[model samples]
Target chain A: QKEVEQDPGPLSVPEGAIVSLNCTYSNSAFQYFMWYRQYSRKGPELLMYTYSSGNKEDGRFTAQVDKSSKYISLFIRDSQPSDSATYLCGKNTGNQFYFGTGTSLTVIP
Target chain B: NAGVTQTPKFRILKIGQSMTLQCTQDMNHNYMYWYRQDPGMGLKLIYYSVGAGITDKGEVPNGYNVSRSTTEDFPLRLELAAPSQTSVYFCASILAGGGIQYFGAGTRLSVL
Candidate 1:
C-alpha cells in the first residue's frame, strides 16, 4: 500500500458550506500531521499544523488527527471562493516525510 | 524579510540542459528542503539539508543534486534535465527539526 493515500477529489461545495478534506496513512509512526493549501500556480502554503492526534483550530480552519485510525482531516468552516484550492496532507515520522495526492476543492458562488 | 525566495519563477529547459534552482531563506532556518509537485500529485521531497555542509536525499533525489554551503541557501542542481523532471519546484525552510515549513512561491520548470 502507498504510505499515504488521499482521494484526488475535485470536490465542489457552495460558498458558506463546510468543507472537509481527509487523508489516510499506512505508517503508524507519523507524529506530525500538516495541511497545506495551494493556489493555481503557487507553492503549497502551510495551513494547519498539529503535533499529534487531536484537534487544532486556527481562525476558520481546523485540523484533526487520529493516530488510532492513522487518519487526518482538515475542516474549513463557512467556506468562501477564496478557499478554492488544492489541499495537501503531510505526515512526518522523523525518518521521512510523506505527502498525499492533494484534493482539489472549488467553492462555488 | 523574504521568508523564503526562489529565483526564476518559471523556466523551460531542453533535454540534456543543466540548471540550478536557487533557494534562500532569511529566517536563518537550519532545516531546508526541496520538493517537486506534478499535476494532480502532492509534493515529493527531492533533497534536504539539516545545516551547512550537511545534506541528505529525500524520496525523489535520483535526478537531482543539492548542496548546503551556508545556512540560508540550499540550491537544487539538475545536471542533465529530462522530460520526466519537468514539474513545479518548491523550496521550504523550518526552524530546526520540523514544524510549519515556510515555502517560496515556486519555480515552474519545463523540460522539453
Candidate 2:
C-alpha cells in the first residue's frame, strides 16, 4: 500500500462554498502533516502544516490531523475562483516526506 | 531570497541522454531533496541529503544520483534517461529541525 492515499478529485464547487480535501496515511510514524497548493505547471507550495494530531488555522484555510486514524484534512471557507488548484497532502517522517496523488479543486464563479 | 531555484525549466531529451538538473537555495537549509511528479502519481522522492557530503536514497532512486557539496546546492543527475523518466522534477529544502519544505518552480522533462 502507498504510504499516503488521497482522492484524485476533480471536485467542482460553486463560489462561496465550503471545500474539504482529505488524505489518509498508512504510516503511524508520520508526525507532521502538510497541505500544499499547486497551480498549473508550477511546483507545489506549502499552504499550512500541523504537527501530530491537532488543528491549525490559517486565515481561510484550516488543517486538521488525526494521528489515531492517520487521517488529514484541509478545509477552505468561502472558496473563490482563485482557490481553484490542486491540493496535495503530505506526511513527514523526519528525514523523508511522502505525498498523495492530490485532489484537483475548481471553484466555479 | 530565491527560496529554491531549479534550472532548465523545460527540456526534451532523447532516450539514453544524460543531464543534470540543478537546484540552489539561498536559505542555507540543511536538508535538500529531489522529487519527480508524474500526472496522477503525485510526488515520488528520488534522493535526499541531510547535509553536505551526506546523501540517501528515497522511494524512487533508480536512474538518478545526487550530491550535496554545500548546504545551498543539491543537484540531481539523470544518467541514461528513459522514456519512463519523463515528468516534472521538483527540488525542495527545509531547515535542520524541520519546518516548511520550500519547493522550486520545477523542471519539465520529456524523454522521447
Candidate 3:
C-alpha cells in the first residue's frame, strides 16, 4: 500500500463555498505535513505547513493534522475562482517526502 | 534568490533516448530531491541526496539515475526513455535543520 492516500478529485464547487481536502497516511513516523498547490504547467507551491498535530490557521487557509488517526486536512474558507488548482498533501520521514495523488479543485465564479 | 531552478522547462524524447534533467539550488541546502508526477498519481521520489557525493534511491528509481557532485547541483539522468516515463518532474531542496522544502518550476517531459 502507498504510504499516503488521497482521492484524485476534480471536485467542482461554486464560489464562496468551503472546500475541504484530506489525506490519510499509514506511517506514524511522519512529522511534517504540508499542503501544496499546483496550477497547470507549474510546480507545486507550498500553501500550508504544520508539524505533528493540531490546527493551524493562515488567512483563508487552515491546516489540521490528527496524528492519532494518521490523517491531515486542508480547509479553505470563502473559496474563490483563483483558488482553482491541484492540491497535494505531503509528509516527511526525515529522509524523503511522500505525496498523495493530488485532488483537483475548481472553484467556479 | 533563485531557490531552485530546473532546466529545459519542456522536452520531448524519442524511445531509447537519454537525457539529463538539470537542477540547481542557490539556497545552499543540504538535502535535495527529484520527484515525478504522473497523471492522477502522486509525485514519487526518484532519488535524493543528503550532501555532495551521497545519494539514495526512493520508491521508484528504475529507468532513472541521479548524482550530486556539488552542493548546488543535483541532476537526474534517464537512460533508454520509455513512454511510461512521460510526466512532470520537480526538484526540491530543504535544510537539514528544517523540514520546509523549496521547489523549482517543473519540467514537463513527454517520451514518445
True contacts kept of 1: 0.72
Q: Give the Cα-based TM-score of candidate 1 against the true structure.
A: 0.96
Q: Weakest 10 consecutive residues, lDDT, candidate 3 chain B?
A: B94-103
Question: Where does model 2 exceed 4 Å of error?
Answer: none
Q: What is the lDDT for B75 in model 1? A: 93
On lDDT, the leading prediction is: 2
Give the per-residue lDDT digits (tens) of candidate 1, residues A1-109.
8778998998999999999899998867636888889999988888988877789999999999888888899999999999999999988777356799999999999
* Superposition error at A106 for model 3 (Å): 0.5
Task: Name the DockQ score for candidate 1.
Answer: 0.73
Q: How many clashes (backbone N, Cα, C below 3 Å) per candidate?
A: 0, 0, 0
Per-residue lDDT of model 2, residues A28-72, tens digit only = 763678999999999899999878678899999999988888889
Give me the overall lDDT of model 3.
Answer: 0.92
* Candidate 3: tens digits of C-alpha lDDT, residues B40-97: 9889999999999999999899999999999999999998999999999999999883
Ranking by lDDT: 2, 3, 1
DockQ of each two-chain model: 0.73, 0.83, 0.74
Q: State which docking tier applies to candidate 3.
A: medium
TM-scores vs. true structure, each candidate: 0.96, 0.97, 0.97
